[model samples]
Target chain A: MPKSLVSLLIVLLSVLFATAQTKSSSAPSDLPPGSTSLIDPEDLLSELQSQQGEKPLVFNVGPSILYMQAHIPGSEYVGATSDKQGLERLRTRVKTLPRNQPIVVYCGCCPWSHCPNVRPAYNELQRMGFTNLRVLYLADNFGVDWVDKGYPTTKGQ
Target chain B: MRRIVLVIVVIAIAIAVYEAARHSSHAKGHPGAVDSPAPQFSLQDLDGKALSLANYQGKVVLLNFWATWCTPCRGEIPQFIEFQNTYGPQGLQLIGISMDDDAKPVHEFYQQFKMDYPVAIGNANLAESYGGVLGLPVTFLIGRDGRIAAKYVGATDMTALQQKIQSLLQAR
Candidate 1:
């Protein structure tokens, strides 16, 4: 009933509204610590085509079916980052490798924004001290980014 | 006095709508909300047995959309099996929906993993109904009230998932 009470309520409501917006905002700039800097699919393709520098170890961190369907040429099949066991498997795969060796990870399971497997895998690699880690950005899916672009890809698991 | 009462109601409604919209966007798979009724669906399990969201009524449900091709999806199956076996007695029903195209691989993975829970084939339509499955192994936690409780988008921690299941089971 008091004016003061109503003014306090309005201020509280405004703060709550702002908090909700921040919580739900999934802007690209708000990338998680678990994420890696994105590498353009086209750039990777060109780099591969140039065959100038040392080739990076590329890993397909998507579904096995997608790998079998068509993945970047010479990309090794790493487990998806969807569950702990898969992450563990990937850890085992790179456990003994040289930490400084350049590595690129991509998963065309879905859009770059929503891929469940790429970020965790990227974070794990970073945590393992893989300094040259890169995430191949697939804006839509692999079919659109890599395959459609006529990039070299290998078939079968 | 009347103005204050009206203002309070408006503030409450605004907060409610904001929360709902935020949650809806997060679902990326389906716009399922924590107290809202879980979406319904009817599909054939791996054994061709018909299953509907209604079948798991009165029980806490963990609806998983996975793919055998997804290592993480495959990796998470053991826990689902464990939850089903451990909590099935306590009214926890686990349903796995494989997003894989061919049923052959799914069947092979199911048997190889010795999955004890019911698994069904999930299509894009099924995925769209839930929220667009952005990636493999999207998991949904549904309460006994037949409402969605949570959606885990990526690699899930087994210990945390179990703890939540325990709490939900005790809620009844």
Candidate 2:
């Protein structure tokens, strides 16, 4: 091939390679930090179940009431999305749980970062001096990751 | 009387300008893109019952995206079941599309909750089709024409849902 043609081919391949890299890099950032952890789902499941005896406070917050229809057993409803009133509701709910006790928070309203409710609720709890606060960031929405994980769930009201 | 009329006219113009500006700004934010079509799919329940988007033709379908491990998703299920039971016969269909991987827990969850409506396992392609669902219990209310009427990304209200459904049913 002529030198000019060979150069053109190289440029096109480089552009394609660069585009591929950009797409691949974006995936990791989309996942929450906690999700990257290799902790066994079974362990998480056991912890969730064991907490049943102690009933470590688990709170669900968001604007979607449909979230309440099916959720982790013994978890409490915080609010409808992470709006101002929902934040206040979370504060009151957190006040009832022991400060030292385990508290897990999640909102499948959307993604964890964009969720108006869950992060604020979790952050507010942290601000209120709650030590054990962890957010379960599911890959898709809550249904795909958590329920699919085989953790316990209950339905309705 | 002339002064008052001038003042009122000015106020009206101001309000119109403000609204016009706001509307224009929102249009820019939308990037001049046509509305994207909502994702559609069909999956089977554990009982071998097939639930398809087409089945809900001419009815507003509330599609709930959730998982079993999600507390919010769990909490929402019972209310959804209630919603289904309360409105199922009323042209309102509540479909729980679970994004669960393993079928065992979902099967158990179905039995435990005694859910009357359909619950099915969600896969990657389905999630992708639904505009990359990000959270648990994300809900989309598709209107009778099958366009997404409204989408609630988190925990939604039962009363609000009922009202929306009623209004949509009326519209249809």
Whole-model lDDT values for every prediction: 0.76, 0.65
The residue-by-residue lDDT of candidate 1 on B1-172, one tens digit each, is 6787798799999999977865454443435545566889999898888988897889999999887756667778887898899999999999998877578988998899898888898765566556456455678899988888877766688888999899899988
True contacts kept of each: 0.09, 0.32
lDDT of 2 by residue, B19-123 (tens): 786545323223211133445678897788997888878887888877665666788888888878877777888788776545787899989999887888876
Query: Model 2: what is its DockQ?
Result: 0.13
CAPRI accuracy category, model 2: incorrect
A10-81 in candidate 1: lDDT tens per residue?
A: 898999988655533431333442244667788888777775888889987776655765778888988667
In the order shown, the chain A TM-scores of the predictions are 0.76, 0.65
* Candidate 2 lDDT score at position A127: 80
